[model samples]
Target: MEDRKDSELKTFCSRNILIILGFSSIMAVIALIAVGLTQNKPLPENVKYGIVLDAGSSHTSLYIYKWPAEKENDTGVVHQIEECKVKGPGISQYAQKLNDIGTYLTECMERARQVIPESKHEETPVYLGATAGMRLLSIENEQLADRVLTMVTESLSRYHFDFQGARIISGQEEGAYGWITINYLLGKFTQKLTWLYLKPNGGDVQETYGALDLGGASTQITFVPQDKHIESPNNALHFRLYGKDYSVYTHSFLCYGKDQALRQKLAKDIQAFSAYYYVMNFLNFTSEEPPSQEKMIDTMEKFCSRPWEQMKIYFGDVKEKYLREYCFSGAYILSLLLSGYHFTADSWKNIHFMGKIQGSNVGWTLGYMLNLTNMIPAEEPLSKPLSHSTYVFLMVLFSLILVTAVIIGLFIFHKPSYFWKDMV
Candidate 1:
């Protein structure tokens, strides 16, 4: 009778302990789920929009950019949301027919209106920056340039956006901005603390890639030189970005763009083909793995030496005008890069001919907008103490550990006989 009574007591205690442990485990799991659900909720995005119209020599392009309002000062935060190419020629071309400029910009403005929310339209700042074409026009006729800008500003003001005024940007500004755009997109400006030792001399500064921009009316080369002393003060631009000071060397050559260069070459040399990009593309010249100078010359000579009538038969789809200037255009590009820019064969490998970077067109327009709006802060923004994921993970891990500890403590207190049995 005593043995049976003891057995019943043991069974009762074991059952009660199991019930408590099960209940505690379920409660812990419930708490963990609640914590995860509460902590991991997504926050609403507060976004801002801006518009930039890049009025180039050959054409005009409208870019709509958007970013998180809180991250406006962060590098690579601004991105192109929409790109609209104006159907007509560049605004500079409408200098004589100034009245038509409004109509020309209407379609793009309407598109911008459709893309952005109606509530944000009034707050969105619109900017127009005319490049080399306008610069040349301004040089030849300052009054005409002024009139063109006035007409452009008036046209843009008709929209609901906050018009920031339109003006011709200097070549130096163009070069510097292009460099900024490239380096910014490349994420060279912001360096993490972990990467400090990787840099030469164990310095915190990051190496920046040089920018080579080729446009319709001009070409710009900008980079931070190895030597601290710059010979030409006019070509040097100093910038303080993300808590780092940069002294950059930049130069923009007017009429050195493929189109203008082709015209100059055609006037002086024999013109057999007219298309600049089309011809080079046909020869596969515009690629990351470009041919050596000797090979490029050889290829061009062979292609240009082909009989004109046979060429017409083979490539009849191409325009006669563009078909005749291939050789001269090719030679001019090589000479301009090699001789004019002084890029030797050894340094030439580093040059990357990119039309776009990270889905945005590589140009001075993005950089121009960044400067005007003060998007790039002079100092680095403070980072958060803990990321949401890391916080969540730590909370879950600690909760698990606490639950395990409680379970072990309960097991030891209730089932001390098991431990004694194991030891024996």
Candidate 2:
């Protein structure tokens, strides 16, 4: 009778112990899940702002850029948030009326004041960079260029933001920065080469695209050439980006921009063709599938042969001054690319005329801002192997799995002897 009583007591205790263990395992899993969820909550983002004024030959434009303060060193972190084109011609054109510089820049500066948060105003740095137009003016009259830049600097100083200086950037600087902008926007700088190694003639890694920038007063071409040896050291630029070194070939042709080339064509007494036809509209030149060199010449020839009166009727909306210049601009662009730059018929397909990339205008301004701010570090920043959320999720998943295994083992151990025998 004592043996029976002891056996009952032992069985009751064993069952109660299994129940306690199972309950504890479930509670542990719940606690782990709650802790993980609480720990994985996102933190607030800290952002920074910058401003660049591209005082181009034809016009002046203001660009506001922003990035996460923590990720400033990362490639492509900075991006244009706002673009305000300053009213009136290029700041260089304001040489005669230097006093009006401040007033002229007011509208755009006001727009900037409205766009950026007031708290960030004092911290945001503002910069102005004049391109070829000012460069030409400076060449003709150095004192006058200096005066113009002085006025521009003074004008920007009135704003609430931190004013960086204003100056005319060299053509070489222009070309190199343009190359950096495109490559950065395209994500070429930080691209991984793991999958590219398997392909034959893939050249061990991804190659960067060449930059062809055409503006009103100058044009620039920059690229990484297959041959490392550059004959013209003057045209060579070296950069260390994302821990990789690059030897880039870049050249800027002053007075070769579309507008300047058109003037040159007119000065040479090139015959003015039919009036009022927008060349892009008539030739379909700006389409996704651009026309071949031969197709372009053939189309231009047929279009230019038409009488002025007939062309006017077809394109009444276009102004007479611009209509007369279209043919020459088109032909000049072709000549500049083929003769001036030495691009071949086969290689012409590689050239891409892009106005913007990834919502930001492709230009030297962003690169210039990046350089001055030291936003892009020489060495890459360190990062965690796994994101916080991922780590937390994995921990929870594994804990649940462990708890399940323990429960299963406890259940089997507590089973009756007959349960195992039936399975066998």
* Residues 279-348 of candidate 1: C-alpha lDDT, one tens digit per residue: 4576787686867767777887888799999999988996666677766666776677789888787877
Off by over 4 Å in 1: 1-39, 72-76, 191-203, 264-282, 316-321, 373-424
lDDT of each: 0.72, 0.71
Cα error of candidate 2 at position 240, Å = 2.5
Candidate of highest lDDT: 1
Per-prediction tally of clashes = 9, 0
lDDT of 2 at 31: 67
Model 1 quality (TM-score): 0.72
